[model samples]
Target: MTAVMAPSSSADDMPRPRLLERIGIPRALAWGFLGVLVFMVGDGVESGYLSPYLLEEGVSKERIALLFSVYGATASVAAWFSGALSDLWGPRRVMMLGLALWVVFQTVFLVFALPTVDFPLLLLGYGLRGFGYPLFAYGFLIWVTAVTPRRRLGSAVGWFWFAFTGGLPTLGSLLAGLAVPRAGAYATLWLALGLVVTGGAIALLLVREPTGRARLAPAGERPVATLLGSLAIIWRRPRVGTGALVRAINTTPQFGFLVFLPVFFTDTLGFALSEWLQLLSAMFATNIFFNLIFGVVGDRFGWQRTIAWFGGVGCAVTTLLLYYGTTAAGDNYALAMVLVSLFGATLAGYVPLSALLPSLAPDHKGQALSALNLGAGASTFLGPALVGLLLGPLGVRGVMWTFAVLYLASAVMTVFLRLPDSAATAAHPATDHPATGAPATDHPAA
Candidate 1:
């Protein structure tokens, strides 16, 4: 007797009418984006003026530098583990651990360390707090890759960055600017803490994607193996390591630029501190929008080509123009603004790398992203370190040239980051199942 076959139901067959999905967000992970935005805003509250504030409080320059160095180091390690741990424990649990760490350490920092100006306690509290946001933010990033379809992954990762940068120095600094005058830095920190808690609760409670609740790696995989795999993938997939280096180079110059560009604009070029700051804000504000634009561009224009040309090569040219053009323009604030804005837009071109790296090792995406995260964390330190080391001997121009060279090198490296034929096909899969001629689902099983 012949039996009639029933139609199979899958995520692809389900109608996607949600506004978030229409705008390229994975429907299930929408709340997580808002959570990241708010959480990063809390974390970034101190970024704009923390060093200056510490100095005013009598913390020595040496101690402030040391504190940030330690914090950056811890952040790097945590960034690596965010993906690795996400593979082992699930993104939600990792994010929760990060939130707990941030709350515990930040309280100790503000209440005890700041009150007494105890350097050791301050270091202990703040350094450890570094582990919080990377885990909280990048953990969500791993969740994005896990649940998002290959076709829309670029756009999804783009949204992840939009929320991330939007909260960070952008809104966070704005919030700090408004609050510090009225509430003072200490109280402002408490406000930041509150935002963090609210954001964490929102994400953890509201987002109910099942994949985030379960291990990303295959069942029975040992924890030790999972972590070691994160390291091993660097060598096993040399392209992943190359991509990490490219990623590091992508932002290293931004941090380095911060070190000396302010002096160049304010002192050398005769722009006011506020004007320099406005320029900085304008740059990143332009970047924030392009992050979303390039994500869609990457998906449509080909990730490799988009990253290589728009991100790598574009940055190389724009980096040079920002320095030399600004120098030539002298007090041409309008011209300077245009140059800096171009640099910022080019910077967003690298957003596609987030989507591309994970595609390299689909079965081991967590490890792949761990490598990417390591580059990101390293940039926080490497850029400033480069400036600290080179500013005296090389001067600003030489340093700008150095950053331009790095961009060119990244462009060269990115040319080799092409996906395999099968992987490329998977990334842009056909709508119908070839064998059965049935509708296929791009969404992976949660």
Candidate 2:
């Protein structure tokens, strides 16, 4: 019997050739990401400040956490479905909806901030924001990957993270800190609402309306409905299963360890709100620098190696230093701040995931990306809660170990997730790891 290979998407599938064939950067893609950054600034305003804002309005911690949990739950549902929706509706339309939601969701809070509305309304408001966010991010990533080169996707994703996580959050927190105090909560809310709307308009221009829902159907797969069935066919492969595990496990440090670092400072170390924001500021700054640096590292050393060297082992050591170094009350704060910077810089394996992830299905970039995003979005909640449970018994120290283990798990799973480098000379014996000195012909992503 003659063997048949799954059809692979060629350079022709990319939107950039006609759009920016001459320019090295995809101007539209850059704009799309920038618009996302702007949208996220408004988003961070809510995440970094909204809980505290609610607290100041006299909400209890238990209630706030319950609200947080509800938002997380809604986001989880959105994550599971949004990518599939983008697949059906096209990334541009899905993203536009996300942007529209951000504008309206916050406005809902602004209008409903009255004391009489009660916590359920507040929960509903937060849930809407949460639902909108990952979908927006999902759309943004799809747009970025479609315009970018397959070979350079890792570095492109690095830039995406630099803007997505580093720049936007930094600005968002700053705006929230500066605006909320001076203008009061409603004023800050109005300003963010305007930003989201303006950002969406820019995105609409930047994203270029999708030519069709998701990737143009495989030659004979005329409708997207047929592509949806292919998703099930692809998921049965070992590659998708292993790839999703690599992505989900690797994301824990960022979603799990990083979130709690702030909580650790506030709850265990006793830092005031101002001090916490300042520390977060430092971490975000460092995150931007590392994002650019390690992205290059992934390009040079190979993404899997970077994950093992930086995201994996680096996470363990950096986290432990935070756990063990500070015995006295205030002593923990300075060391924790330093360690948090390290986490921002080194916990960057997630950036390479965009490249590593899409390559998993080789022939199905859309489904692969969706699968990975689904895993990652789900991890946002799972990672935090998994560690949160451990925190009660393990205390700070025990949680550190859990974080370390999670990073280690992320690293080990790399054994199963490999991306074949198209740039590699086909003539070279396929026996070497491109980025690492070590031989990794045996590894999945090698």
lDDT: which candidate is best?
A: 1
Best by TM-score: 1
- Model 2 — which ten-residue stretch has the worst lDDT? 1-10
lDDT score, candidate 2: 0.61
TM-score of each: 0.88, 0.81
> Total backbone clashes of model 2?
5
lDDT of 1 by residue, 333-391 (tens): 89988998899899999999998887677656788899999888778767767776777
In order, candidate lDDTs are 0.80, 0.61
Model 1: lDDT equals 0.80
Give the C-alpha miss distance for residue 76 in model 1, angstroms: 1.0
**Local accuracy of candidate 2 as per-residue lDDT tens digits, 51-132:** 5666668886456555655666666656655555655566777776777666666667667843444777777676676777
Screening candidate 2 with a backbone cut-off below 3 angstroms (N, C-alpha, C), the clashing residue pairs are 301-435, 417-445, 418-444, 418-445, 419-445
Candidate 1 off by > 4 Å: 1-13, 58-63, 258-274, 327-333, 432-446
